[model samples]
Target: MKCLSMLAAALAVAGSVQAAEVQVAVAANFTAPMRKIAPMFEADTGHKAVLSFGSTGKFYTQIVNGAPFGVLLAADDATPARLEREGLGGSRFTYAVGRLVLWSRQAELVDAHGAVLKAGKFERLAVADPKLAPYGAAAYETLTKLGLLDTLRPKLVQGENIGQAYQFAATGNAQLGFVALSQVQADGKLKEGSAWIVPLSMHTPIRQDAILLAKAKDNKAAAAFMQYLRIDKVRAVMRAYGYEH
Candidate 1:
């Protein structure tokens, strides 16, 4: 029965080669890129990444309270650092530097220099809630730097997060909005309408970071996905979405 024994051993080896699924919590600003990359990761490694998107701040709260996420891709570096300090995460690194942009679905609405802020041409200008979204904080900083915060306060409509802020602008609920450049860019160019890329000097850098949660420290699938993020092909996908490594 040597052949039967060998067949049993081969089946055991095949079972050992099968990959596991990992759960990930992603920042709202990164949803698009992650959506594109997750399947690629699964195809390459035989591992599955189940992703959930939302504000990093909310994710932080959930993680602290024992959410089952194995990894976190935050919109800003601070949240990931905090998780590490709190002993909830390990092996953190800056994955991308995010850029903020002033976008309008309508053509000729937002000028290249973003001077429309001073002209008061729009009835409602949307921004993500500064308390929840890092991009929202950057938007607030940009407005303050441009001396428009006080003047534009009355005209502001705040979204729950950057994704929602983008929706407000896209659906014409708000005339224009401050959103992540990735939301408006595709294939290394603006997909539609008018946009003013905010100068990085106007606000603090949005250094997005990723971390392996302590809960998944020993998880092979979680570790594989984290390594996949650093691969050149994945970085290229991130670049197409306007992220800088």
Candidate 2:
């Protein structure tokens, strides 16, 4: 594949620069793209990104509780902004804009218009904990905008993070879920099942932000990783996973 070839080529470009690792706290919804980017990042920059993924809120709590994360890739802009305001972070920037989707592992369970929600055909619907994951909040906002929140509240199942919400649908624990589009799509196409790409108008934009944590202010690898996010190849990888700038 062209992408694999690119990654291999990038990895072959060994540098004379010293190598170091940076601990990164990443948002759960960004798991797929971040996994691909990490290897490419090491190959290109001679630095390894040690990644840990979870809900933005939980990661924030961990960061506040003395977690040694050098950088944070958050699911929402607010978390990074809050860190920067509190002097816990620096060099904050918007890395990606996430899209929400109503998805199901079954080929036709989810309709293009997402009418199935109002039809009440499914017994369960999964969403990440809105208090933790921005995608979950967007899901709730979508339901409220559609006037279906109260009607569907009884059937809602909550996950600690977007990854778990996606798992609930993938494993059939729920008939459907509100999840990040990146989880079910790749190379500009759906990897499996069916989904309704939730309209942006239904909720506020999910502006995923990245920041350099104060703890790693002097860490070269952390600084390099933040700068590396602006490269074309890196942006290209993000696009393949359904993220928008």
Off by over 4 Å in 1: 1-16
Residue-wise C-alpha lDDT for candidate 2, range 151-240, written one tens digit per residue: 999999999999999999999999999999999999999999999999999999999999999999989789878877877778888898
Question: Distance (Å) between predicted and true CA of 104, model 2?
Answer: 0.3
Badly placed stretches (over 4 Å) of model 2 are: 1-15
Local distance difference test, each candidate: 0.90, 0.92
TM-score of each: 0.93, 0.94
RMSD per prediction, one decimal?
A: 7.0, 3.7
Rate residue 212 of model 1 by lDDT.
Answer: 99
In candidate 2 the C-alpha lDDT for residue 95 amounts to 91
Per-residue lDDT over 1-245 for candidate 1, one digit per residue giving the tens place of the 0 to 100 score: 45544543443343359888889999999998999998877766677899999999899999999999999999999999999999999899998999999999999999999989999989999999999899999999999999999999999999988999999999999999999999999889999989999999999999999999999998878887777777677788999989998
